[model samples]
Target chain A: MNTPGHGQEERTGLGTFADNLRKVPRRFIESMFRTGRPDSDRSRNDFVFSNFFLHVQSVRTHRWSLRWSTTWGLGMVALSSFLIATVTGILLMFYYKPYPEAAYQSIKDIHFVVPTGRFLRNIHRWSANVMVFSVLIHMARVFYTASYRKPREFNWATGMFLLVVTLGLSFTGYLLPWDQLAYWAITIGANIAQSPREVTDPIGLTPHFDPGGLQKLLLLGSDEVGAEALIRFYLLHVMILPIALCGLLGIHFWRIRKDGGLAKPEDADRRLGGPDPEAVPAWTAAPRKTWSLAAVVRGRTPAVGAGAENTVPSMPHLFYAEAAVFMLTFLVCVLLSIVSDAPLKELANPNVPENPAKAPWYFLGLQELVAHSAFAGGVLIPGIIIVGLGLIPYLDREKKGTGEWFGGPGGGKLVAWSAVFGLGTVLALEAIAIRFGWLRQWFPGTPQLLITAINPGTVLTLIYGLYSVYIVRRFNSMRAGALGLFTCFLMGFLVLTVIGTWFRGPNWDFYWSPSQWPGH
Target chain B: MSTHSEPSPGKPSRLDPEAMPRRDFLGIAAASMAAGACGFAALGAAKLPKAAVLPSAAKKFKVTLPESLPSGTPFFPEGRSVVVFKDGDRVFAMSTVCTHLGCIVKPAAMGFDCPCHGSQFAPDGTVLRGPAPKGLPWLSVRSAGGGAILIDEGTVVPPGTKETV
Candidate 1:
């Protein structure tokens, strides 16, 4: 058990060197920033000269304990991803061009001409993927540990935003290569992100407006997969997304400090009236020592006697562990990059039309909606989905549970089972339809299915509404208010995502391409 | 019991004095040990850096001619610069380095590509790209001051400047 400072004994007289330097002159002090006394301890000096990786991770170490280290380890994955992206991105910048025609050609040159250009590109691509995945897993860990309970709700929201932005960063980067895959993938993605109905029907004059106009408008600045799109993607991927991520990440970290560090899994049980009598006090009541207070305002009780009185320091065990994880992830990414180069397709030709154009896998859920009618999956379904997701915190007001796993005696089984059952049924039905070729009728040549008659969306929505009603009745019978409401929102998202994936068939069945190229 | 002697006044009390019981001490120790183990495991899981030193056996190629390329054209002359030429296709040779903090710039129809931060560059090596302060640098060329076309890979001319071969 060598503590962090064990190595420092060998360098005890290091301060004398600084003292001698300080005695040298006021002239030197004026040359640099005029500073008074040099508080130059060995560790303090270590902080200044250490590598960039170590610089960011130089937090105060506490007594030997593992709880803080695990959290640190998880956080390090994201930090490492960011670091790798920065380095690889800088290297790639040396070879990449942002113009439309040159973007793809430049990438090709990097692959074929420049020394190790392929390796650099592959690292950047793989690191981006790794970063996104790590962030997601980190979110999951935080949720399962009940870190988002009470005082940390704001951080939770910020985490959610970061998740979206992370995906956005990845999505925007997809189009920079200006190749066929990048172009079609972006087109499909934008088409899937049709404007909300509310935006189109402000006064409700037209319950349904053609999404084509809005879609085109959104793609206006990026008409072709040329300079405009490349520039847009570049700015978004490097500048905009990074800034947003950094800002939110700062707030997220601050929230952890504000909420009183990380919440243990047992916090959920304690919050939900468990037998733990020694609950910590609310953050406001004992603000300075608490890691985060967002949970307290959300009606969670702090662990009793959990104040800073006997608090352990955040030692190197966790920090070292986190550093290791970061290295491992980087190595894995590099290995993947070297082994597998990302797919590079033919130069982008907007004139050529490809069948079964699809969006990114994440948006497959939304694409599933296009199977029903143009309006259902295309216009109406996506609109509802976004609105619902945006208003999640407001819609689901259950306070009894925290994290993915519920607390209390029965442990959120009711909500969990219902969600599983509902989603399971929809998936099963959709799989059956796809397997049976029942959806073929909705293809381009076939007549469009009746909006209400054969639309899977209509049936799914009706089923969901009925389930909601049943849940409400069941809640009344069981006397569960908040839990019931939470279940409803969760169920709604799961259903929409699953159903959206099912119905959104190839091309979104949008006839724009064919209509424009008549007699082809 | 009646015959028992009284305790001495100077001696310390034999009654329990420590705040924590043996069970509590053992529990805390075990918890601390578990935490320490987790930290160690996490540290152990870190990945190591790959060997990045350039191989000694690698070959090098040199450029011969410094052709006056049009603004938007790419120069992929077999093994030299991989920059794409843009801006109406007359094609001037430009570096693919993104000016905005140096991510390799990709070529798009509108401008140069920045996959890291979306910086755009125009054909004439202008800052059509963002996060970049300036445009890509053009390599200086000389006709070996004689019959040979000698490209000085070391010397770089700023964008928009014309140099003779």
Candidate 2:
């Protein structure tokens, strides 16, 4: 191989030796070990590929501008969670004995003996919380942007499942501390799960055995919150959830390729012939060939026009920006973790009762349901809502397409207003019921009222059912295209209600105990 | 470059048009020389620091002294140490915490080694390797009452100080 500029003869030294070696089947090794000059494309690629921090980024396409931000946001959250898990997990590992007796004491050691142990644990706890928030927000962004439409629908569905798993991961991890807060919170959560089924036989000849009691058995692996529960939760949190998330994430990325980058509404609408094709090219050419799987999947045949060959790949710019955003987000998570450690209450003493047993904030929506009749709010409602959310893709059925591709400004308003009025009415009515003590009639007395009032399961079911009806009606009225806009209000309301309940304090309590049975 | 004088005669003057005025020529020459000198000074300054110390001979050590080194003293040229003293005996030692990436700094002449990224430190623990922000920390030591060496691990003196350890 001739050396450029320095001359062919000049390559007689190490340069020629390297060139000669390149002829051998050691190309993979050469590439693997190669170090390029800084600022060169090769070097930047290497940096992104090899570096741990940068590797998670390196997304391929630039078709969707905001899509990059979404991916970046999600990726940052994941990276931050990983970092927190690593730091806290390692610190925790030092003191965390997997055995039931040792687990609690290990946590104590982490709090007392480890240098900055509390800080590490807090960061891990808070980052886990923030990761859930980010992942949800990322999903919402995808939904609002219509990123889940068409070919990407399966990935979107997978993402939704991942979101649930993420929350589950956070919830399960919370109990590992084994303190009073963790214990009671999980207890309340499990009971809420049992409430609906528990009352099924009340009208029957046999004494009604709470079907919901099964939840306790399943969650705790026994009658009460004890050693078994802690180990079960720990294994789920550390091992199960991470594996599920990793698998889903793989599918999510692959779908991006299969579905074609981010959905551009203009291009999507054009494909369906709802819009003028002359206004833009039939298909938006991906920014770069290298970043796109288009050629491999769709074949190299030219679909639109000639000049498509010259486009630059999206890898260097848009993907780079995504990386920058991820870094920024991770930095924020670290800052938050360092500043706020998750509070751990006094150790669990089963004999003692903390007056207002609270559930995790996410579960507060369900707690709110318990304010209604226990059967309606605690059992039937949440079960229905979870089932409904899981079946959203099948139920909605209208092919709206993905991202910005399904364009139009029609009928969205009617759907939006309908959902706003319907879901909004349920939340408002529930709030009113709790404040005015209207649901007390069903419970018989204070104990009964506490059991029945503000049942989140019921409230969620009612809301989901009503919204589903409104959605179906709106689409039947030819407002299908505007579902995203219509649904936005309900989403906002749910968020507001959750936030409100979180800040509401003691008066909003809903957990039950045998001694504090209704009518007491 | 010669300039011919004008022929003195009634017939014609033959002074070359290219001959510049004496004052203007002198001014231009002086300006050019001044600019040249400035450029040379900048070049010299740029190269001076690197040339002054041979890269191979750069001294780096962790300074741990039983006796207190004053604030301005250079302990190790580029190393860091934790110093402790008992009764009359003074002892100081270096830690291996790498300045970059928070990895444990390893033992080197003046300072430590960063295993994670392969950053080298001078004996005084100044970064001999790229990517590190600063040098190793110097454990300051001072003689307090009762003849005990008061090792002030908290105070870090800047590099290149002239005071003795």
- Using TM-score as the measure, the top candidate is 2
Across residues B56-142, which tens digit of lDDT does each residue of candidate 2 receive? 221232333435554323333232233221222333433343333233444545445543334467665655542233456555445
Give the alpha carbon lDDT tens digit for every residue of A37-141 in model 1. Answer: 324222232332233433332222212114443354566677688779878888888888887669899999988899988888888888888887788667545
Q: In lDDT terms, which candidate is top?
A: 1
Cα lDDT listed for each candidate: 0.53, 0.52
How do the residues A222-297 of candidate 2 rate in per-residue lDDT, one tens digit apiece? 5456777777788777787878877887776656655555555544333444422232221353334432323233
lDDT of 1 at A220: 27
Q: What is the interface RMSD of candidate 1, in Å?
A: 18.7
In model 2, what lDDT does residue A302 have?
25
In angstroms, the error of model 1 at A210 is 8.3
Cα deviation of A124 in candidate 1 (Å)?
Answer: 1.8
Model 1 regions lying over 4 Å from their true place: A1-76, A143-146, A193-219, A222-225, A265-311, A371-404, A408-420, A435-520, B1-165
Cα RMSD for candidates in order: 22.7, 33.5
